[model samples]
Target: MSERATPVKPTEEQEREQSRETERPSDGGADAAGPGPNADGATATEPVTTGAEAVVRALENAGVEYAFGVQGGAIMPVYDALFDSEIYHVTMAHEQGAAHAADAYGVVAGDPGVCLATSGPGATNLVTGIADADMDSDPVLALTGQVPTAFVGNDAFQETDTTGVTTPITKDNTFSSDPDRVGSDVSEAFALAREGRPGPTLVDLPKDVTNAVTDREPDEPRVPDTYHVQEEADPEIVEAAARRIEEAKKPAMLLGGGVIKGNASDVCREFAIEHEIPVITTMPGIGSFSEDHELSLEMAGMHGTGYANMAITHCDTLIAIGTRFDDRLTGGIETFAPDAEVIHVDIDPAEISKNIHADYPLVGDAATVVEQLREAVETSPKAKKWRAQCQQWKSDYSMAYEVPEDEPVQPQFVVEALDEATSDRAVVTTGVGQHQMWACQYWTFTEPRTWVSSHGLGTMGYGLPAAIGARLAADDDQEVVCIDGDGSFLMTIQELSVAVREDLDITVAVLNNEYIGMVRQWQDAFFEGRHSASDYHWMPEFDKLAEAFGAKGFRIDDYDEVADTIEAALAYDGPSVIDVHIDPQANVYPMVPSGGDNGQFALTEDQL
Candidate 1:
């Protein structure tokens, strides 16, 4: 079994039958290809199986070690086939959890993650995760079971047009009608998910198709011949961009998620260091650059570091790699990097000038294009004074929060304490909210794939499920930590049961403020302090809740309890939750309003 596969034991009867078959069977069949006489029959020259078995074989051929999903009627055929296969299936608490888990697995493992679900609500439940992957460019392959082809358009029980619903979100989608072609459809979907600009793909497997018998085997996963990605940018354009960088008095390098996805972190890091340029990353690009380095400006955006924003405001040359320039990162495009000439590098041609206009667009693989620039550059930029200025800005606006003796526990304190306790390589996952920002700001990321979270879609219940995926993908030495908020945790907390069942070692720290913290903060800043529906006063005690789910639970109410609770929770063998009650009034600092200039950020509401 693969290391990632956790074998689910078979029943006594099933084991006995398997032993009997092993003891009696000795007729090995010769390798050949032909239509099967029957589902179970095999010839000396040909081996025959059902379509469902072929699906499992295709996954095995593709080296799939793990899969995440739920059991259902339409998908029962595939699940039954999986029972005999070596692939390990993580039965998630919900289909949505399954989708997010697969997504995070892809993010961490650098391979396309697989998920499965049945028609109707099960298929619908996966929509959010699919959309999340679509927006963030995470590679995920979703397999959804549909009603039998005969019943597909008849509105039969549990019937759903899954392909129709997911077409807009997936990079490609297929509805399998022929048993002979079903396995290939799945392979194609899996291939398309990780090709070029990575994104989600889906294959709708109808019950009849999966149930039908077939001898045809799926080919190795491959995209159509027509599909192509430009691995190397135009050599002339790379030369021009290098010239701009060499001539720049104030130059900065911006790394995005693509730097990590395309496996270009090392080259990008080397290029930046060789040229002595300050590096800034967007939220999704957190781990692409080492924040511990002197040239690092951390993340740049609405809640980015003050110095990072300042560098963008005044830099004469901005070499942005792998980012789509989301509005959150490029606040008020008219004001963002106004003085700089932009050199944008992205694998997708559509993203080059889609948002912020790229003065020098270099469209190709991130690593390849960066290597091109590295070879083409003749002289490094002279930005000694500019680098010093960024250092000074870092000192001027430090990421410090006051945890007074008389005040409630600060969320920042909890974040830092957790970071201090875990190794630097520990994988961090989060849901959308104040806690997410705190994790992004306080936790120092120095490695790619170390940071996993819902970025583009901002899904609330992403943390715990993501932890499950990251834990499976991560090495045994690396710890999985989830920094979630009360609201976000509550959304997907049910997955805690799955973690406990699997005996996964992960610690979830819920920055419990008894409110939809980010929404309440926004209400405070933008809505005249009206609480409205943002308050979450009736929240459950997450520490006690974890215990109810048969896992260790700890709570922190005072500064004295913070360290001990986190230690105790991390020490526990299985899933653990530290419900650290944070100060309700605390808010994310260095804030920028929608479309505001990145340079003019407020440290507090009064400043706003």
Candidate 2:
């Protein structure tokens, strides 16, 4: 006899089945003769399966080797299944962190990253990260637990209508009403999240469905056609774009995240060099073009360098690739590149005229479009004036490192030291606000997708979890560093446990200033130091918190300690948190101060 596992204790409904087999459910029960054939020649399968088993089978079928999420009552079954399977689940401190981590994972892996969260608050907390992925078009799958289906509309404990809440945010949303279909739902969710115009997708599961048992067999998921994008780009549109580039005298390239997503960085760089044109990147496209390249200008828009903004404004022809012109980058659309004749090339057709109008719209894969552009530009004359203009701009506003000769430790110094120590090869994730902006300005990333941050969403507390995901996705030899603010670090500080549990040797450098630095900076600048209670002098010691979570911790008081602390953290086998105290009253200058006019910056007599 085949060795039968112990029968699961039946529910009261199943007890009635024991008395009369005929009264059992019609779908898949103990007495059903295999499965009935459906209209498509496929057999009708059981609709009841453990949520944990479904999660594992679905992930395996989706070819996902790992995911990141925190374990809670609603998500424990999925976690248990992950534990049993070959797949690794890196537990994190908060749901938003996991989502950001998933975004980073997608950036490096070039595939949809998966994240999980419990019901109610857990799902709600992931909204910001979801919105981030949505705005940036990052492929991410978020699984959330829900109260049992029977109690879904009753506001049961820890339950929320996650499907309803995430519907507008996600590309698609689904709830598991039947256990047998859970794997299929997950497969579709992953496919929809990754294919065509990538974004976030949600799959909500009920608590009881996770624990309940049924006569169900897991099967490999099939990829459906619904998720794929239209393959053809308009030939007429491509020809028009080629014509524009050939005729233009002052053409420039504006690279964005889509190039990275399409792995077209090499193609973009080649095109830029061949035409002798300048390349200005969005925040997401920082590492796409080498900072050392003469034709590569800094990022444009708010927080961008002055030279980049000026170059974009003066360019007669703009070749925008793989990016939507976000408002933050455009400074209110009307005044953005108004004089430039834009050639918008993107994989997503919806992004063509969503914000800024495009004179020549080329819709296709970024890599494919770059290849076409390369072919088209083979005969075009080199634009020497454009190259000279770009060089002059770079030379004019070359990123300056200004500091007092005998000043105490500055946040920029820490970033520079960390960059030097890591040989500038590490993937840096950052929390939102001024420190994040500082890292962007200070760090010189040499490779594409090296910086993982929530640019569009601007979510705080995104650094640690994103670093965790980056470490998992990147080469085993490379280190992952998190640049966090004291306020941001404390918000999701519990993620240290995940790093410890998984033995991920990641480092978090906390720029502590005993206050919410960004808000405090605003208060110091515009609000006249009203402060509004941004101080957190009584906050828990980060060193102690790291120790509590089974990781190493250190405090850096002197400038010399920055490199050593980072080195020690990188060398350690477990996670580490380094808390560095900076001047609490310091502010990030070059301030527009909200409502200020362009090119009007407050020059500080001395940068603190």
Candidate 3:
């Protein structure tokens, strides 16, 4: 039997303190305690500490290592406090870059990454990153400095409703007006950001509140009362799911990012191997299962491997673990796995039937549920023929691309070359577009958390900063590479300066096609080849741009120079950019048309 441990109940005194904290105003104000001795043996009348100090102390108590952001006028107080704290602050070139760096930091570090921004445009600039974190379910804490509390409603300079603006994008948002509650507010923000279905959380700190003095001691980090303790799936449900699997002729498993979030990759792999189940993953789920495994069907969806999509399309029973049936994975809802009976396991009950209906909805953490399912399930010979058939499909429809003999380089070849050079040991990050799809398809990931990208939001300008953050969080010798498209790289090109200043050894590989490649492909297929506003006209020279940012740059126009340039860029001690010109007319093949089923993929040029 799986251990069913419950959360420890709070003591009476602790309960009373929590109640008092809850009743405190959203606007910053004094706590219920007067100027007396506090629980930590410190007198309330003891030398008051600034709210900024208290915020730093709270983050320290919560075990945050780095804070990523650009220092601004309104947020200078926190920066001042950071000077005295143990936390390292990474100064990014832009607020959006900072937010993305924080998000990626959280992903690689396995903790909530913190970002600080000022009010008004500074806070607004973080919206894209915040939304990206929210969509991808990454835990990130965004701290925004606001105008003085007194001037909040007066339309003061740099004033904005930071909490109001971020409410929809964050798991929770708070406006702190009282210096006394800064510690508690920040602590809660960290907890909420990580608790159940992790996501971004925002805390709005008014400048006046940050400057205000407080006597409150920083509390030890504790699980928020609202957080639900994860439990193993019910025995009966696990048994029933096992029975369904035992009875099915063609059983398959679908993995997602949740498997990584729950740290269940090993157990998931064990279950798949034991049952001889073929595994397919979503975009963010790329590394959840080892691509080299025999049963691994790299990724299944639009732009997925032909064999993987075929497996998902033909499988009779699908055991979906921690994956939400998003539109990208499910080409068209009506035709997706039409004959399969899904046994869905997710931590969030709301996600169980939110998209595709689940025949067995087992609500628990992926690690716990997968373990229970493994224990309940018995080896069945029924799936032997099915596994053999899937293996044949994998051999027959393996991913393939043709390279022209001419000079123009193909983006797929670049990715394949990087894969060969890196040997799958480097942490790979990418911006959205054709480059992202190519990275997902070509790069073989053998470990979890090695592949990072903006999966759900599909945000461009994510690669550079995310690679910076990933490099900082990774081991000293781990190579970090960002494969970005020309259009995507330009979106956050300023981050090149941040990489140079930090002396991070990261390689940025730009597939420069001189056009919005993905958009151009769609236009070519559906818009009668009318390429309007898609071409770049060769505006900015990327190698020069990298050099201008104090980083080494190399341009590869000929196919002969691709391997050496990539190797040289990787060998550089500091940041470097390798701009390889790809065929402008090339397109990502094996594409399922919008609203089309997985079976409706256009594999060859004639099909398109």
lDDT of 2 by residue, 512-608 (tens): 8888888877776667779788887977788778998988999888877777787887676668888888767656654433433224333341322
Off by over 4 Å in 2: 1-52, 72-80, 207-223, 589-608
The residue ranges of model 3 lying beyond 4 angstroms of the native Cα positions read: 1-48
- Mind sharing the TM-score for model 1? 0.93
Ranking by TM-score: 1, 3, 2
Candidate 3 lDDT at 157 equals 91
Q: Model 3 Cα RMSD, Å? A: 9.1
Estimate TM-scores for all models: 0.93, 0.86, 0.91
At residue 577, what lDDT does model 1 achieve? 92
Name the weakest run of 10 consecutive residues (lDDT summed) in model 3.
Answer: 1-10
Q: Model 2 Cα RMSD, Å?
A: 9.9
Question: Over all chains combined, what TM-score does candidate 3 have?
Answer: 0.91
lDDT tens string, model 3, 1-608?
11111111123545434533442122121213322244466542244489988887889778776788977888878877765544557778899999999998888777898999998999999999999999999999999989888888899998888888888889888998789988789988898888777899998988888898887866666556767856677789889989999999988899999998888899999888887889999988888888999989889888998888888888899999989999999989989898899999999988988989998999998999998988888765388888888899888887877888774888888898888888555789999999999999888899888898999999998999999888767755467899999999999999998887666778999999999889999988889889999988665889889999999999998878989999898888778999888888888878998778897788865686
In terms of lDDT, which candidate is strongest?
Answer: 1
Kindly list the per-residue Cα lDDT of model 1 for residues 277-309, writing each as its tens digit: 999999999999999999999998989999999
- The CA lDDT of each predicted structure is 0.88, 0.75, 0.84
Model 1: pairs clashing at backbone N, Cα or C within 3 Å: none
Q: How accurate locally is residue 520 in candidate 2, as Cα lDDT from 0 to 100?
A: 79
